[model samples]
Target: MTTINDIAKLANVSRSTVSRHLNKNGYVSQEAQERIDKVIQETSYLPSQSAKSLRTKKTGVIGVILPKISTETASRVVDGINQMLQENDYQMLLTQTSLDKDKEIAFIKLLQSRNVDGVILLGTNTDEALVNEIQKADVPVVVLGQNMPSTTSISYPDYNATVEMITYMLENGYRDISFIGVPEDDPAVGILRKKAYIDTLKKYNLPILEERMAFGDFSIESGYDAMQTIMMHSSQPNAVFVVTDNMAVGAMQYLKENHYSIPKDIGMATTGVSRLSKYIEPVLTTIDFQNEDAGIAITRLLMEKLNGYNKTKKLTHTYRRLSGNSL
Candidate 1:
């Protein structure tokens, strides 16, 4: 491997001159620039980013901590983050927690130890331990999903969006709409969304049936089981509101397997529109949270904080309802 010192010697220039030419931070003569460029092109020399980070205190890298990497939502968000980061001459060091809260906290410290310029957490819960880690992190930490205590965060319109979807179902003559959701640890999707279902039903003076609700772990299998459980109950709902994309797909699968036709036998609506939603049978009426746009916005917030903006930012990303034949 050709080092900067070798490039300097080959170009017959001082190491400081080579450094200036590489960083463009200081003045180097035009003639010297040409010589350095020629030698760099000939040798294919790559500068050590670690050395540059030491001088500037920036790794030119951001740490992205995700809950799960195998989902459509995570892919879209990563695409958006990578797009904006590349534009700003930075890249991400990615890590997945697989929904493990402790891993989220551990990765923050590990990324900090590596001196990442900032961290973007796709949070599942706002646990106190996680909040404390963010608060004490040496680099700025910006959360993308859940609102954490005293930290910059961008949250989804979980409650409002769910209410709108349920209301739309109600307007379409879905009187006995059931709910499939996750645990309350995720205050956004689990708690607020479930609350929205109950409130919307109550607003129309409809009963919130105990057997009409089922909880999933945000998985397609869990969604299938939830749908099965609700369907097997004494009373069956004409419509069901699901929170996440994976669970929604599972519910749709169960309904189809059991010979239930969407919107005729049972209707469905959900959050986080999947990429394949349009092609799926009956399509999927879901909330388009614009995950990629949210990802870009989340990254920009961390970049702003890195650029010395200090105020804690609390933002709710915009959402729009995507009408599908399922509802």
Candidate 2:
């Protein structure tokens, strides 16, 4: 129940001085700052953002959700999102889910109470619970990964991109191809990517063997484990298509440790044209989803929906092949 006026009175400063200090707009003398700081600590006073939002009926803040910011792909997406938000004079608040679908739902429900203008999810999964939350949210929510059947989503060309990458590997004479993927529960990188791999092989009249496929948890360690699992099979593959760059790196590490050289021993490729690719030996053949552009496009969609563009849209973002020695 403490208010700015109470803080001003207790700190022996005018309301304007308190406002200046709280907003960090105008300068407050060091002496005045000390007084305000002391009063704020003593009272545990916080700014009433709800009041400002009530006055203007808007918050110049957009909430962004990501799976992992540490990854280069996510970082590029954020760079694009920040660029667009700054151009539009809006601020951004970001949080990561670390690929936890439950946390995605939790944040969607939590964002509703936090007064965000809108939300943009760098999504990884499309659970029904998540779809329901997105549907019921007061503010417009745009997803930028999985093409949620009922939501305004900008999806990567997962199926097409995977098919292209696999075809490229085949064109290079890699008939015995293996796949490293995530769990099928995630429709985008997990199911669609794997489906593309199998379908492409079938189109080429290649056998889809169970021993040549393995799944990962989107971690480098899991990638290594999956690679190990595939290599251990008696009928080993000459090439592997990994669903993510982080997993690709893990697979690469396993290859090196096990004295299996890349491309020479087993060629490899993956989606997510990440920075890690540049430093890795023989680089990597990856499907470039142009994530920064994807971010910009998705943010523009959110801005449009915020301004009253009605019918929900599902868009497939573009991608291309990046050649490297790995393939």
Candidate 3:
């Protein structure tokens, strides 16, 4: 275990000088810095992370709290965050809250206790307490996927975007439309998409049928179940809009298994245009949410916050729509 004392003795400088040089908090002369650098290289001395964190109040680690990490979209966002963090020599500490309000609040406190430089909350559940906690802590907290009051966030237009897709479907002469989405309790749930679906139908004076709506967890299995439920209805919808690609894929699988022809039998559309969507037979019609770009934007914003830029009052990020084959 090589310590700063060993390097200092070898470099013929005081330990304080070595500490200042390694931490980059205090400056030393060029000659002394070079000597310390040479000794550090020769001795293979690595400074203690705890000591560094104490000196700079920066752990060189970012906390990423996601609502439901098992989802494909969340996984892709994590990938993008990793790519950027690796390039910047930063590390990510991931925490999954499973959309539990109590768990999310506890996670925030835990992140703060761990002394993370900042935190990126992937999504918000129904609790507003976390926003106050973030503000009181005076730490940089950036919300992704969902908006928060009195905090900075990167948001997607789930409501308007879904309406746009549904409008397109209606215009295409698809009358009997059904929506598959997550439970309304989850903040990041597909309420917006479902709302858009209902709103569009109402604007056109279409009857709102209770059997046309189905709620499930955001999973392929749930999508399959929802689709089955919708199909069991006396008057099945001619077209369906699934809130997520994962569920849409599942619905497609169920349709295929039942020997139903896509587009010919029933049209399909969904949000999120992942790679899996393309290889499917009809090539799902979806709105590309640009998840990767959103991840990059959120990470960049986190960096800006770390660099002392205030974004609490500004809405700095938004989303774009991608029209794909499934629609």
On lDDT, the candidate that comes out on top is 1
lDDT of 3 at 160: 84
What is the model-wide C-alpha lDDT for candidate 1? 0.91
Cα lDDT tens digits for candidate 1, 1-327? 999999999999999999888888899999999999999999888888888888787889899999899888899999999988998889899999988888999999999888789999999899889898899888899999897779999999999999999999999988988999998978898899999999988999999898999999888899999999999998999999999978989999999988999989999999987876667899898999999999999999988998899899999999999998898
Worst 10 residues of 3 by lDDT: 311-320
> Which candidate would rank higher by TM-score, 1 or 3?
1
For each candidate in turn, the TM-score is 0.91, 0.83, 0.86
Tens digits of per-residue lDDT, candidate 2, 161-246, equal 99989998999999999999999878988899999999999999999999999999888899999999999989998999999998
**What root-mean-square deviation over C-alphas does model 1 reach?**
2.3
Q: Say which candidate scores most in TM-score.
A: 1
Higher-ranked by lDDT: 2 or 3 = 2
Candidate 3 residue pairs in clash (backbone atoms < 3 Å): 284-326, 285-326, 285-327
Give all candidates' CA lDDT scores. 0.91, 0.90, 0.82
Ranking by TM-score: 1, 3, 2
Determine the backbone clash count of candidate 2. Answer: 0
